[model samples]
Target: MNSLVLFLLTVVAFGSCLKLPSSFKKCDRKTTDFNQCLSEAIYGALRILDKPLPSHGLPSLYGVEFPDVFTMGNSTYGLLQKFYQTRYIGLSKPENINAKLDFGPLTITLTIEATYSQLTVETEFEAQGTIVLLPVNVITPVVYTLVNPTYTFTFVLEEYEKGTTYFRVIDSKIDAQTQGLKFDYKGLFSNKVLNEEFNNAMDEKWRQIWILFKSFDEVLFAPLFGTIFNDFLKKVPAAELVDG
Candidate 1:
């Protein structure tokens, strides 16, 4: 999740400097068909962002690396977990991508939604805890393959200036729905059979488990997203993004 957020920030921060090819479309906020145009523009941009734009200081989305380690403290949540060296692929290939922008009298609301045919996440984890009262002592490779997952991000932005027009997210929400999930774990229970069974059970109940922890995930992600977004906005004048 954290790596996903970082990928977005990387795009926005460097995207401002892109001397987009003439084929890339631009939408004027003043047009009555602005939202539709913006959606198309976003879709076109996604198709081309897989490659690095070094002249614009942007790395390829396909090969982005995440080196930070994350620790989830002990809690009733049932997992004392730490994960690091994670990598994800297939972010630049979202289907049915759309973006909507509503500039109200008091706030600017932006929503982006997309579905991925398959998103693969690989990471190493160390966990020492209990789930369903069963001991969990494992340090191994874990792979999550999300099939046909749709993700939506909505932000209510407030305008501000740091020598230029910029916006900061004052409120935000993120939601995801997946058609299917596949989980791979090694040495989960010190028994291959138990591991396979546990993985299957988790895949079957992935949505329910995500819902149980969604709020906690939001608490950890929202502020970090806001901060990174604000930094990105600082690089490009708000007027250039939308002239209202």
Candidate 2:
């Protein structure tokens, strides 16, 4: 009896997850590239497409965390006129692949959240029986966070592959846009006045992190075409893109 109950619960859970979005209904049998069609459907649900190549509406939701703790010398941040911090803090909201570039690139508008970063330098002299090496040997555990804030992305397609008529992205890079960005630092510094000064100074800043958010759609694109790509790839008669 317990086994049967467990099996039924599992089915119920999975059934809800497998529910296809009403968006896919647009992908009818006549569509030549089922892989492409499926891609259009899911992303299109987010927003109507504008430019053609790289088909718009791709979802961009990815989070990256650096494993290593930073310990940069003070000379490195001399340009920024700042020191190191505690830990890195930052998060991103899912963005949509809306605009496209003629040179072969795309842009995504994102909401970058705030971060909490702190800096600690090592010194040659001991503080309370601890040896430190000035700012050069700083054990900087940076905390940089970007609370949900509006931002845009512009990146160029780097590489791609295809087994069926569909495509898969390999990599990409950032193009022109707002000044290189940094996340909100108010929460970390705990100084509203100082934070405001920094925010106001670099109001137009943007980050490679945001670019990561946009480019990630390429990661999802190929996978989305997975089942369909295989279906046509293996199907007899070698389906043509237009009618397959």
Top candidate when judged by TM-score against the true structure: 1
Cα error of candidate 2 at position 171, Å? 4.0
Task: Kindly list the per-residue Cα lDDT of model 1 for residues 1-244, writing each as its tens digit.
Answer: 9998878876765555433456557778888989988888867766776886544334555544566677876836687888777776776788787789988998999888878898777779898889788878778998888789886778899887544456777887777777876888876778889889989999888887667435533564455445545555555556656656
> Which lDDT tens digits does candidate 2 get at residues 175-221?
22222344443332345685466555543544645465334323432
Q: In angstroms, how far off is 207's CA in candidate 1?
A: 3.1
* Location of the lowest summed lDDT over 10 successive residues in candidate 1: 55-64
Where does model 1 exceed 4 Å of error?
A: 1-24, 51-79, 130-136, 162-164, 213-217
User: What are the root-mean-square deviations of the candidates from the true structure over C-alphas?
Assistant: 9.0, 13.9
Question: Candidate 1: which pairs clash?
Answer: none
Clashes in predicted model 1:
0
Tell me each candidate's TM-score.
0.73, 0.30
lDDT of 1 at 232: 51
